[model samples]
Target: MMNRNFNRRKKFIFFLPVAVLIVAVLGYVVMFLWNWILPEVAHAGKLNYWQALGLLVLCRLLFGNFNKGGGHNGFRERARGMRAKWDSMNEEERAKFKEEYKRRCGGWGHHRNKE
Candidate 1:
């Protein structure tokens, strides 16, 4: 299995420039799209390369993840834990848990018999 704690610094060294180029291309695309469509449609002003780059950074900061590992925020880890617990549960335990969850969450026609 691949090491989960692989050397991040080494990976960054290999991928940093590629990542930068990708971001630059994305910024250019944003600038092109905005210039192409927005001005005529919404009377928006045009953006220079620097402005586009700034906008890209701003959007990333506002709506995207700037953190390392793309900001998974422990979701993958939590999911793995949940999956493991679910897999370990026996059929009866699983059924009981499911019914309890439905009861707590308000069953949506789950109380009705299936035809």
Candidate 2:
């Protein structure tokens, strides 16, 4: 019984390092493939390890959302920002912005008032 327990513990120790190695290797391969297979814009100027990590964090902050069942939330945020800036403008500027936004985005980004 003691021998069996010792063997089990030994196997557990071996398995622990193996599992960690597997994870590390997978991470390395994924990072390598990301750098090798993808373009620069996809990485957001993240060529090295630290750069990739930093860019990942910054990009997540600038545009990180999984909503509306699609990957277009960044565009939504841009639209919202444009709307808020337009609304904060003076009447003349707002009118001009409305025209431009309407021309560019079909007025879906601007708020319309109804009588």
TM values, all candidates: 0.49, 0.36
Q: Which residue pairs come into collision in candidate 1?
A: none
lDDT of 2: 0.68
Badly placed stretches (over 4 Å) of model 2 are 40-115
On TM-score, the candidate that comes out on top is 1
- Candidate 1, residues 1-115, lDDT tens digits: the string is 2564477766988799999898899889999999999999999999988899999788777766767756567888999999999999999999999988766775575664343
Whole-model lDDT values for every prediction? 0.85, 0.68
Candidate 1 shows a clash count of: 0
Deviation of model 1 at 94, angstroms: 1.9
Error of 2 at 64 (Å): 21
